[model samples]
Target: MKKEFMKNSLYVMIIICVIGFIIIFSSGAIGKSMQYNYLQKYENAVPSNQLERYLNDITSNFRTAGQVISTLGGFGILLCGYAHYKEL
Candidate 1:
């Protein structure tokens, strides 16, 4: 039934939100740790080596992507819920 589908959708969305939170937090922590490690090693110098630059760029991109996904997923969930509610 539509109600069951809606409930299932909500449940899935809840799980997705939790996953998003984990992704955001873990990515952020990893990024910060990488930055700190670089600073400690280089005495506040920017990443001069190719490997360091690549790692920093990848981590930064992942963190940004995780945050954006989390936000968009949450909004999508809200919209889905609203749409389902109106249907009911």
Candidate 2:
């Protein structure tokens, strides 16, 4: 039962890690696209309007979320590795 649990935990951690990676990459791509569009529209100026600021905030939030999720996933993966080692 314990071995089965450990195996399931490891699988869950791996899925988390994969999801984290996907989020990180997708957020980066989305952010870059947003920046590009903003730059094209505003010509290198910082966000000065409410809408622009809102868009910027959204991008920032996505990046922050991705970073947090990835970090958590990394830690979870590390913990799973440690558990596996201990079980062996």
Candidate 3:
């Protein structure tokens, strides 16, 4: 039972890591697209409206969330490794 639990936990951690990476990559792509659109519309001018500022803030938050989730997933993987080693 314990072994099964450990195995499942490891799988979950791996999934989490994959999801985090995906989120990070998607957020970066979104940011780049946003920049492209802004430049096309405004020609290098900074975001001036509240909606634009809000969108930037949301993008920043997504990046932060991705980083945090990835870090947590990495730590979880390491912890699982340590536990598996101790069991052996």
Best by TM-score: 3
Model 2 Cα lDDT, one tens digit per residue, 14-48: 78777777776777567667767777786767655
Q: Candidate 3, residues 1-88: lDDT per residue as tens digits?
A: 9988988999899889878888887885777577667667766666557446746766787788888898889999999989999999
Candidate 2 worst ten-residue window by lDDT: 46-55
Q: Compare candidates 1 and 3 on TM-score and give the better one.
A: 3
Say which candidate scores most in lDDT.
3
Report the poorest 10 consecutive residues by lDDT, candidate 3. Answer: 46-55
Q: Each model's number of backbone clashes? A: 0, 0, 0
Ranking by TM-score: 3, 2, 1
The order by descending lDDT is 3, 2, 1
With candidate 2 superimposed using the best TM-score fit, by how many Å does residue 12's alpha carbon deviate from the native? 1.0
Instruction: Name model 1 segments beyond 4 Å from true.
Output: 28-48
Error of 3 at 50 (Å): 3.7
- Pick the winner on TM-score between candidates 1 and 2: 2
Model 3 TM-score on a 0 to 1 scale: 0.71
Worst 10 residues of 1 by lDDT: 45-54
